[model samples]
Target chain A: MSESPSQPAQRRTALDALHRTLGATMTDFAGWDMPLRYASEREEHQAVRTRAGLFDLSHMGEITVTGPQAGEVLDYALVGHLSALAVGRARYTMICAADGGIVDDLIVYRLGDQEFMVVANASNAQVVLDAVTGRAARFDAAVRDDRDAYALLAVQGPESPGILKSLTDADLDGLKYYAGLPGTVAGVPALIARTGYTGEDGFELFVAPADAERLWQALTGAGADKGLVPCGLSCRDTLRLEAGMPLYGHELTTALTPFDAGLGRVVKFDKPGDFVGREALTAAAEKAAATPPRKLVGLVAQGRRVPRAGYPVTDASGAVVGEVTSGAPSPTLGVPIAMAYVDAALAAPGSAGVAVDIRGAQEPHEVVALPFYKRER
Target chain B: MSINPEQLRYSKEHEWLSAPEAGVATVGITSHAADALGDVVFVQLPEVGATVSAGETCGELESTKSVSDLYSPVSGEVTEVNQDVVDDPSLVNSAPFEGGWLFKVRESAEGADLLTAAEYDAFIAG
Candidate 1:
């Protein structure tokens, strides 16, 4: 816990004390002292799949773009057609460098006719802030860094809605997926979004930092009898991996384009006017349509050995074909699963001859669809 | 079962070896190692008849988050591996000293580096 002379101190969330009190094993994540797990990561993962899991997502960055041309600015700044996004709705989008390299994948929430909020990964917050600010210079809009202004908490799982219903009077049933509304939850003003990274029916509540503890306690109390557990980043990683969602530093990176990661759908070519990376993304989209150099695919180990991140994937002849980006022993599947970017020819779901180099041994694996698990409606 | 530190020799690599009976000793990772490694998911043990050297890697224990090498505290011939542990790796976390005993080795030599429980405790405390 001692900081080295050259290293800066890790930031602590508003509920840092609460997490420690609950016996969370804290770890450094994206320069923040976040909980890696409260107890067993496997148990936490299973709870999220079966019951409900609460998450402290305050470390995620929130940048607000407001004013007359806010939508116009975002349309020119990100890959998505944000100008067309209706108020109260959210869109999964990405901001790429001029060369089409992914800067970061983002969730843009249109809060008003002329106001939008861009949520970026914690590690890429400042980068995204600078990118959006620079892109908004000529527009009649303002980009504000609201990272420290809010604390985000997520209640995710099948039982999430029932748990949240006890604390919030918001129209939980009418709140469509990817939509948000300003409301009061447990007497605290908040933005309740029906959005989540975990592939579950859940809600993410964004509230003032000062009100975070109260809201968390209220939700915990309400969810106590519903088998809700405070989960940590360890289970979060495995949960998202099982859902086939891409993580910023892992599945998405500056070296890869949206098309390269098989996320070409996030780029809206029909959006009016030129945006950042538009030309390059257009070419990338065309190239992807013809023959993608690498495509992201799911991998299930045929053995017990886990194929972890950065492990090399090989073909039958021992030629390296790809590398694992995110992996874990899926608590749901009871097997090791991973997502990897492999050569296009080997990306098909049932393609044979795929193996992961676990240490020096090439353990055989089967290529499958992107998501290893999906919630049953 | 409960660990009697006085009856066991510990390795700096976080393994615990019991006092030899007829030159055969039971080996498993210490609870501290198990807790640090998190939930153990998979294990690879040296096969029966395989010769392992003191302070050398004899197997691997893969946790959900990461993997660690299992080192033999004594140079010996592997007599048997606990198949129950091989079938259920979580025993390595739940019962590291009992049901999780990885293997029994007939020792030819014990490593001079092995520590008493007190010394091992002090070593890990640092």
Candidate 2:
């Protein structure tokens, strides 16, 4: 979530011109030219919690697996029980290496009986593509990298339904969470999914690249009175942090298994057939259940100083026990919250002897639950 | 770029120092610094009676994006700290020159030379 190091080149999304025209602070995110924020990040963060916010997520990679054995192939490729997923439903799962380390967490949306869309993070797009493709080589399925062919947009928040209802003829009221369907939005073909990372009611619209700008314009215009604003990666980070959603590089990483990140529920052990990382993850799960090394927990700083990623987490005596993964000054909670990997003994809420080393000063904090904020439904 | 106040002296670290009166001068970060840092979430000011040196980091400022050190423009003993800004850090961004003043410092015997508004402007432009 910090600044990217200088790279040789960067890629632009379909709405690059639109974002630049609106004076977005462009940053290099996983080699893609993406907006960090359009206006005040705090204001944008608050807007999403209160009203609505639009996001250009074209950089997120999409891979399609289609054929008779597509579901079986995904069951072998990912940690979730994809073969049992009903059509039009989405499952949050992770693609892991053979050793059970997380490669990437994904949202697998079953578009049809033989078709499923795997949305991966921008940094892990190619990794997921290669992993899924290689895993499906033996199955009667075809894995196609459709990232460059589609543009993704997300309108998230409380007022999302009303704003999106104005643009699309689809049954926004009936769209259940984690379900997706093909429909025309703003006169453009799209796959509208009732899923979001912000932990709010929202839709993730997938459209063709050429129609991205038009879709964005239509949403902004239709959402004028709904308090929808163009949000960027900055506010998105804080929002997800507040919601306790894990980002790939932060909460989930290659070095940590799904069990270590407290995401062992995504691993389906009862599924038939040997899947990649199944044996190793099973062992890791058993060991973790016995005596977990470290677990992810929420931390709220008692003082003003915000504990950032990679900062050392200290015990009562100021001994380094863990490290912070993601943190921000939450606009909704009016306090600084963070996710850290601490010893399992100290992972419970209100555990004592917890502090964050904020630039050599051991600022005390309280270990709270995963999410610091939850919207009233 | 925002205009640098003519009455206040400047520091290369993007801090503004008011002319010392009664051996005390006020301190605050410039608008440019606030703009670069985005909305300020936390401001750590030097405690009263603490001795600081010119061009040294005395405290820290944190934003949503990252953290930056608050540099002391002139060496002095910290006299007063702004409790308002310490409570509501956004004052540093909304009213940086007035209510956002971080602290007041009593000048040392060996006063430090600082930049004029034009010189600071030229320095930032370069």
Candidate 3:
């Protein structure tokens, strides 16, 4: 799947029955009974393209950090500088190990001067919590796992704003990308963030699971004329892959450093003091300037053949150069595209030719820049 | 969502085979299989001349996130393969019975022992 394996198949949310009714190809992803797709991937993909789509992202992890030094703790624990973030702003940051390996990439939301929320990928919920909890405890800051009480839903696509605005009394006009605010939907309290992974203008709503169904139904019923459709993981993968988004287990992992995954900007070395992995990050930066590990680059298959995950990457001489970490046939681009970590020399765009061992035969490919597709919608 | 066709014999793996009305048996994956796979992006069936036995792996069908083996329900020498389906695999999802058909074989009675649609459903339930 696009995310991590959920531990112990946690409780199902209000959308379980709806998914079954819609005939979703249900699977265990991050311990949630999520939909892969309703019926046709083409139709689902086009819905968000032409109109709006709703997603049940309740399986994601939400952790709250509140203390006098909460900002100071995350500033050191996460790779990005958090001290400059004003209230209601969210920054995508990575938590790195002492050796400069990524533990998880999460969205850090500054609620107030001393209170913050970090939403992590479901599979890495425990990993991020353990890392942050351990670090926050050093400063006596409380790290609470609010995942159990929270249900996350994404209202995505071009028509999302209009459909969702009618249901909420809160003003949704001023909210920009990566912006968040306390809002209400169907008279239930929730946190609305103007961010999504589908390369569309959408919002991520965090509300109680008890109210999830009502809000989802109200939005879906209200947005029906506006072309809003319920999306599953199937279309979700294609959408994010088209947007050049990095998945947890594939692009980012506990073993891979942020620098190796084309995330050098997220690592803040000039934060004025030593943070977690600070020395190693500085050292990795210096080492990378000399010899960067096989760099991550975009791949475009020559034919209709899709380059899959874990497929071996080879050079013109047929020698194994690296491996494809994540790939998919983009429904948006109508072409096969992928992302792989190849030797830094081969990582240069258009400079090298490679082949992916697709199924049994090798298919030719060209390295392109990240984000194989981007649309105004 | 529905049985592929009555005349065609079904396999537990969800393939359908019809004996050649004139010595040419046809083969295609069932509609259920195509739907379960979500979307049919890539199909790798044997060449038109490849010999295949009943219940043997003949080709592969890959979706956005999975790879499944395509098994033949009849034993015969492949006489024709649906190149049209290979070019546009979504046909398999939308038209698994006719346009999405994978390959055809010369008439072989050995392939006739495959399950019927009802029996195949029972096998999946079990």
Compute each candidate's TM-score over C-alphas. Answer: 0.97, 0.94, 0.94
TM-score for chain A in each prediction: 0.98, 0.97, 0.94
A222-331 in candidate 2: lDDT tens per residue? 89998999999999899999999999999999898999999999999999788999989999899889988788999999988999999999999888889999988888
- Tell me each candidate's i-RMS in Å: 0.8, 0.7, 1.6
Model 3 over residues A1-377: C-alpha lDDT tens digits? 24446544445767888788877777778777788787777678889877999899988899999998888889878888887898999999999999999888899999888889999998899889988988876785788998887888898888999998988987799887898999898787889899888888889999998898888889888898998888987888888888888999998887878877878889988885568998888888887778878888889988777788899888888778888988877777777889998887777788566888887677899988887877763
Q: Which 10 residues in a row give candidate 1 chain B its minimum summed lDDT?
A: B1-10
Structure candidate 1, residue pairs in collision: none
DockQ-based class of model 1: medium
Can you tell me which runs of candidate 1 are displaced by over 4 Å?
B1-4
Better of 1 and 3 by DockQ: 1
Q: Candidate 3 - CAPRI tier?
A: medium
| Candidate 1 local lDDT, A209-323, one digit each (tens) | 9999999999999999999999999899999999999998889998988988888889888888889998898888888888778788999999998998999999999999999
User: In candidate 2, which residue pairs get closer than 3 Å at backbone N, Cα or C atoms, i.e. clash?
Assistant: none
Q: Write the per-residue lDDT of candidate 3 for residues B3-95, one digit (tens) a residue.
A: 646677888778888757788888898877888887888898898788888888998887887778998888878998899988998889989
